[model samples]
Target chain A: MQDKPFMSSLTTDEVATSLRRKGRWGLGEVLFWLAAAATLFFLPERHLILNEIAIIGLFAVSLDLILGYAGIVSLGHAAFFGVGAYVAGIFAKEMTGDPLTGLAVAGVAAALLGFATSFLVLRGADLTRLMVTLGVALVAGEIANQASWLTGGADGLQGIMMGPLLGMFEFDIFGTTAYAYSLVVLFVLFVVARRIVHSPFGLSLRSIRDNSLRARAVGIPVNRRLVAIYTISAAYAGIAGGLLAQTTQFVSLDVLAFHRSADVLLVLVIGGVGYLYGGLIGAVIFKVLQDILSSMTPQYWQFWIGLILVVLVLAGRERLTERARFLAGRLFGRSAGAPRTAPAREGRP
Target chain B: MTPALETIGLQKRFGGLTATDNVSFRLEKGARHALIGPNGAGKTTFINLLTGVIPPTSGRILLEGADITRLCPELRVQRGLARTFQINQLFPAMTPLETLGLAVSERKGSGRDWWRVFGSDREIVDEVVGIAQRFRLADVLDERTSNLPYGKQRLLEIAVAFACEPRVLLLDEPAAGVPEAERHELLATVAALPRDVSVLLIEHDMDLVFSFAERISVLVNGGLFTEGTVDEIAADPRVRAVYLGESVDE
Candidate 1:
């Protein structure tokens, strides 16, 4: 046995050193939150677009929690999204119109489904997990279609009336209230997620993702952690779906559609993975690009979107960010170390 | 008295081949034991069975008198069984600091706390730093494990096992690929391990096995051929026959 360490294992100096190295709120984080808040004042005309971005951003964040952090590839995240939408829609119409209660109900319903299905994911590799998840979404979509009375079948669930958020600020025609409400929900959940991803549990998830056998050898409960994170991510997706149902007062079969799941995956890849802001940034770019391309070409918009995804994939997210930084330097005449504030993506390729 | 670890009637048959055939062994508390065999003698297979990597065909594994034959690998580790891989299995992307910190945190049951920031956990950070220093990994603690030198990577592998505060440590080829210059340091570290933790070292190097292990077990054809102290094994005619190119029949 080697001699004990010099510090006598007392933990005084080491603790001090650790505390000193502790990461606090960096300038980039502050700036990112500030910009998100500033959107309310600067983008009044695009409230609907911003509201859509917030909802999709939440969905992408949920995917990142499982896919990027936990290394669980899910192809049918829309299952939870659709579950939340239908549950919230049904709850508001049949029971209470209170938005928060509806959101809670939606999250719980989706989380239960996620917890039940998590066992399937725990047994397989990436491809198997993908197929299982996609199958789940397909099954869920069928259920929604077949159960016409509760889910309104193919036409979708309509006549959802959400009471004012906090019983004060009513949802509006221009989506102003919806934007603020969604942004607040997004911000609160983002904080919770940010806290989670930086904590010891978050670090353990990354370790498991990197090497699960070693993780198991080291006494990390690999299966339990995966199941926990998967369930939480499902709840997050459910909340995003609930936001959509509440904001629009309409729930459709598209809530559980394959396109919804596929779109979120595309958004995450475009923005980047493992990083919290990847989903938010990806949703913004995905929605904005969709908006512009659909208006311009209408029929061929998907082609343009596909082209952008291919370009992003080929260039690599890190390389594109580097090139963007270089171009920005050339354009703005700013030096390399000019306190550049990017959201916390960590930029690992 | 109960041995620290014991395997009773342990047998593993892969199809028709008996990789380990009814091999029973005992390791006393604080005993420095070595399991050495020629190529294909199932040294690694035995270690795998002990560490819960693979289930034995028919046997019982007892840790301090409690049967742990059916426990999962992680549960085994939690029960104080730790092993370093024959091949380096450190996480490639994580720095030594992060890897060690994670292991320590898990040991302390803070592994699932999503609210506590890792850097702020002084006790864990301190323990990790101390382990890194003891393993001579202080300078490269911040460097990725994959980028570290091979010898250093081997040391880090041991360091990670130590982070678990294990009662039984299975060291498989601790100095297999280490360079000649670093071999002394590696052996010295192994030699100096605290006596409270019993060590079962699986090594092919005769010099290391003779010097480090208080008792040695020789395995031939997936079965225990002989067992004795360093001197007794050295002088035994049967042991000599196995090593000196003489068949047991002869």
Candidate 2:
């Protein structure tokens, strides 16, 4: 206890030491990110594969917010993603052609819905929460199908023309804008999410996830925070969906399918939840694998995915999780030279 | 000042079983009171009711002269009511300093910042340090609450709760798992509480109870069995025969 005066008295080293105690992502993250950025730039665009990867990456990262940081497990997050895409699509058809407005409208709409139904998530266990979310997405998807006038129903919306970026920056033929647009979108959201995870609100979510009862007893208002985070995460998903509709002028009913959401979950899990950047990396890795497996043997793609899933589960989620976290840290490690989170507990920093 | 809290006919039932059968008591501001009884005395249930966990079947809970029986837990907390568990309630992965910062933030209404680094809140940092120091948790501020010794965990739990600066605190068996050597520290902390802050402690350790409490209440089964000073309780023949589980003549 005596060390506190000296510890608290010296503000500089405390925060620095605190950050150091949190451990630095260091050189690994920089190299991985730079290399990743270089690869994306150098690699020739082929069949919109790179574009698809960006969309899925963003989707997976959105799921990571709820799954990893908030300890929420959802298999139906794609519902929000799909909803955003549809909103964006409809906006492009009727409203001004600027994609960002559509993105904003879609995000706000999805976030509002996420906030409304979040209470359903706050009370239930992980599995129960997943079911409720999945059901919500399923119902929303059905409604979209039934509302043929607005959503284009089962036929899906076609000829979505996002006039341009801000009605000026025309999308290039090489998809350089699409890739850069998606990349920039992903980068900004990731940073915001990072700030969130490191913020007090973010700490509360982790607290709720780790021990809801304790958090409540300490007056954290657990349920409210849960709902808020869910809403915010859904907003992220909405933005990701918007990015998709923007890059591709058409959006199909398949975007709203349950499989899309399930795939997003797989990305986070494969990457590792809770560890920031795990979902992003997981998205890239999962997309690549999906691409490779589908190309090698299109018919048996599921079989390869299933086999890999088994290995991932057997080798242990913890192992892959650590690897994911390590990779994520390397790619997005920014904790270096930053102030610490909180003073250590017992011996934990 | 008025009593920190008061409960009237706090009747609570789970199905056919009455968990708290017509219990009522008043905790004056600054009073160090102890509720002592044998096991299954409904002590925890009473705390739960006060904390808005389970609604009392037919009762009213008032805090600082305000009717708070219908208030939710968080709302009640906002109105300056706080409590701790019989078992240690802690965010295991977090350090004590982090834990207290959160507790202080919850009190200060800054717990909503989802992007602000908690350590960046200088006031909260100072307050956390202050609370942790008072509870003797400053030494282990960086350690995980779960990894600390059982006694230290209890101390940290109390410290964290204190970060809220609640007007009243309900401690459920603070000395339950703590070692004999460190029980005094726990008792001393409870004894040293501010005179204006009320504390209602539940414990089975009669010696510790007798020392820390200026007033005492005995709970038998699910009802208030008796209420009196420590001397009155120690002198009561029925208390010895019933709750002490010993011959009154002894």
Highest lDDT scorer: 1
Measured against the true structure, the TM-scores of the candidates, in listed sequence, are 0.93, 0.90
lDDT of 2 by residue, B14-131 (tens): 9998989998889998888999877777888888899998899998899999999998887887888888888888888888867887788788888898666656777777677667
Report the Cα lDDT for candidate 2: 0.77
Model 1 CA deviation exceeding 4 Å by range:
A1-23, A323-349, B240-250
Model 2 regions lying over 4 Å from their true place: A1-40, A320-349, B246-250
Residues A37-115 of candidate 1: C-alpha lDDT, one tens digit per residue: 8988998889999999999999999999998888899899999999999999999999999999999999999999999
Task: Looking at model 1, give its docking quality level.
Answer: medium
Instruction: Tell me the whole-model lDDT of each prediction, alpha carbons only.
Output: 0.86, 0.77
- How accurate locally is residue A332 in candidate 2, as Cα lDDT from 0 to 100? 62
